[model samples]
Target: MSTKTVRVLALVAFLASALVPAAGWAQQTLRIGELAGLTGGIAPYGVQIHNARLIAIDEINAKGGISVGGQKYKLDLVALDAGAPGEAVKVFERLLTVEKVTLILDGIYSSVEYALGPVLKSKKALLIWSGGNDPATTVGVPNAFRNHFDGGAPFMKVNELFLKKMGVKRVATYGQTGHADFKRFVEEYLPKIQGIEVVATEWHPFGEKDFFPVLTKLKGLKPDALIVHGFFTDGITMLKQAREIGLYPGPLWLNQYGAAPLMMDEASRAIWEGTYEILKSSWGVTTEAPERSRKFFQAYVKKFGERGFGAWAESGYDSVYILARAIEKAGVVDDPAKIGAAMQALNVPDVPELLMPYKPGKLFDKDRQAYPKIIVSQWKNGTFVPVFSDFGQ
Candidate 1:
């Protein structure tokens, strides 16, 4: 062949080789299922979690995948949208039986977690999820593990501090009637605070947009603080309507969930300003936050163009790394029992890829639930800033 022809052929051969995996060193595929509410009422938070899962899987695969038994295995994520409990159960079964996904990253939605219990037990698959603050759902489950906030005592303590800081006396409660966790946070936990009396309580359906009538009733009750328990969209709608109807100036707003940056995205800064909240993660508010969190936030913004990326979605990202580390520790790629054991016994310091802060010793306690460090964050001038943290004290 002529020299020019040989040069062109060699260049084409180089490009083809680079496109294919190296012989004998090619990475194997390990499939992970991601269950989230990509549609319906919970879509706002679900999309964020899904995005984070994608980022984590991409980063891991880029770093030559997970090393197990001296072999490289890259993650293949299969995401499904199960916005409700009935749908979630079906999706959970599909992920196990059809998709054959033994490992899953479940986004926050406690009712769905409860519904998936029997299936998880039967399939013996590993489910690392967010939410399920109730100990009953998390404590004794064998295959189920939580990588999110503990809403029992730790969350209550932070809310108590928030109440004290706001000088809240009589509080009115409002939340979504559909979500068990959100309803319980407003009905069960808010009433438990010693000094504050739950003066008036009202609940709206999952997708209610107009809150004028309820706001009117709440305003007449004259509460010192109002507890809003819905997600960012509905939460913003309720607060904005409250301001329009002249109820906001009367009651100090206390968000039952974390103060998400998404709230500011949905509504203006002036709408949620001065709102007291129990922050799930101190990603932006604290200096001690994990370095990966800062990098992850930047990556998310670069990929998704920054609507309102919050730390709440970091659990999904952490779940991916947590499982990868477990696979490494177990020395096997496909065994669920060994992998689950490794995850349960995971030491936080060992997994530097984690974005959320975990309590010392292990990621999960005896209950198989990880307790995230709490921060009392409030909407200041234009951002959510930390006021108190349970980090050192």
Candidate 2:
């Protein structure tokens, strides 16, 4: 036969061999269900997490998804909105029994997390929590993992750093009524600090328009510091009213939840200036973190307009990527046990995108329980800058 004809025949033979399907080519796709509040009170945080998860999933798929034991499987994301605890429990039940999701990612409020704990424990579904910070959720649940730092621990740390170090002895506390977690932290934990006297504690109904009464009452105590714990809008309103009543200019005004990027804008900047906040992580600190975090920040700005990338946004973004990495290491899609094991074994050599400068084994215990260190961040010149670091000078 001629050389050209022989070459053509060889090419045809190779093409025919390639046409045959490989063994186990029809693998089932893996599904990760997300129960988020897309329209409720914490919708902004929920939406940011959901969008960041989608970004990670798309990037994984673009890289041809993850390969497990010689089979490639794509991720299927099922998102459902649960406006309240009752609705969240219903949605979670449906996701487990009906949707049969291999894994679940959710950031429902603390109340919803507590309500769904028993249900999730019974179902044995692996849960990656984003929003709930109550320590009770992590106490005995073996299948659950929390991505955000516990709120109570950080509050204590902030009090130690600011009130203790700055010599602010007497403090007045104010918060919303429905915030059981915050109140529990303050009442139970803050009093444990030495020489810190709580002169008065007041709780207002959520969404109460006028805070003049509360401010007037708190001002009457003549405390050395005023600590405010509430949602962004409520905190802003209280701060403005406190300023109007001449209750904020002299005392050290501290806030826990209101120092987020969205709350510290042009208008609120003057109001929240010099306010101390406890945060788990932040971007633009290249000294302690790996180069990947910087890359993630640049990519995020390039994709989404530079608007609301705060500490929580970084946590949400990193949570998805960390889960994906765990799945890749676990090498199984359907087995929750294996996935959980893989997550527990993950150790990023350095801080990656959405990750802080946390030690591997210390950050998460053997049971996948996380105990992240909290940093005291301050609003300096309209930016959230990390000022206190356990590892830094």
Candidate 3:
């Protein structure tokens, strides 16, 4: 581990040892584990999500922690900087078998989740990711939950707004090929479309700045539109390059871009003038988010400034609250199956409990994945104009 990770782990160890109740009190300590990229390329995401988790923990602990059965418990976080995919597997194993944590949060990458899902399910430890929306992520894993599943309703809504409404016929898509969720989405969701055909599809590494050759090849296909799915930063860079090479093929649609205003610049923002982007919608800075969302946004801004809060920030916050609510409602935190049922039962719209938008009357699907519609925004000049909000699947 790096010095930073060591420091974080040391702090976690200290908290685990020191934060306990009186010997006679009816209070227990709940330990939650996190394995995310803290010192790598996705470090910003790790920091944003980890801090958001801390905010939720603080909020719950301030209310006398979680009440289970007939006792109260204080929350404690044990985090590790899961640097690479192999490291994520190691950390996940350590968290479960050694530290013996019941619930683990913030496996940010679909890659890590894909690798760890079977083991986590078998071990009966609950693992949740705030991001990873691909349908394949949930495929046989019963103990895992994703806070966003854009592949369902939010995804179709984008198709309706673009392919059907705008009448886009042929299209091209580009993303990080090595990404598990991206590949799964292409395999599962692409062929299901009725009216449109994907004329071209390209994949590259995450930070591949030279999209010239890729765009050049794609430009030759003469597709009606282009769909860009990947990191928001990559989307911004790809859009800029596509504009520079004069490969303006229909409207650009962005997915999983947790970044809106933070990733925009004068040069890149100019290129997205007519692009359409979809996201979790509840955490969007482009629209009028919930009142509590504003409060959460302001808190993050006050501490970490306004630049680093990705789309995952609100989901990270909501994930903790959801798990805590389930733990409290089930009256136990050790049983993962009961906790999963409690999570499913979070069907009512308790507005104050969420910093992100929940469905009008529900929480999770039958698979225990989040179900929320996406927001469609069109870039107009320097700002994003909300063209439509489709809550229907």
Models 1 onward score TM values of: 0.87, 0.87, 0.84
Clashing pairs in 3: 258-311
RMSD of 3: 10.4
Question: In model 1, what are the clashing residue pairs, if there are any?
Answer: none
1-393: candidate 2 lDDT, tens digit per residue: 999999999999999979976668655467889987677666756666676677677777777776787777777789999779888999998898888885888856677888888887777678888766665776577788877666655546655666777788988888777676778866887787778888888888767789999898888888888777766667778888988998877677777662465424678766777776653444443233447666666666677655655555556666776677677788877778788888877665422444554545544565455555566667666666666644211
Write one digit per residue (lDDT tens) for candidate 1, span 245-279. 88876777777655466534544657787786664
Q: Tell me how many clashing residue pairs each candidate has.
A: 0, 0, 1
lDDT tens digits, residue span 48-72, model 3 = 7887788888878988998887788
Model 3 TM: 0.84
**Once superposed on the true structure, which residue ranges of model 1 sit more than 4 Å away at CA?**
1-25, 131-135, 257-259, 262-267, 285-291, 391-393
Which lDDT values do the candidates have, in the order given? Answer: 0.76, 0.70, 0.71
User: Candidate 3: how many backbone clashes?
Assistant: 1
Task: Report residue 85 deviation for candidate 3 (angstroms).
Answer: 2.7
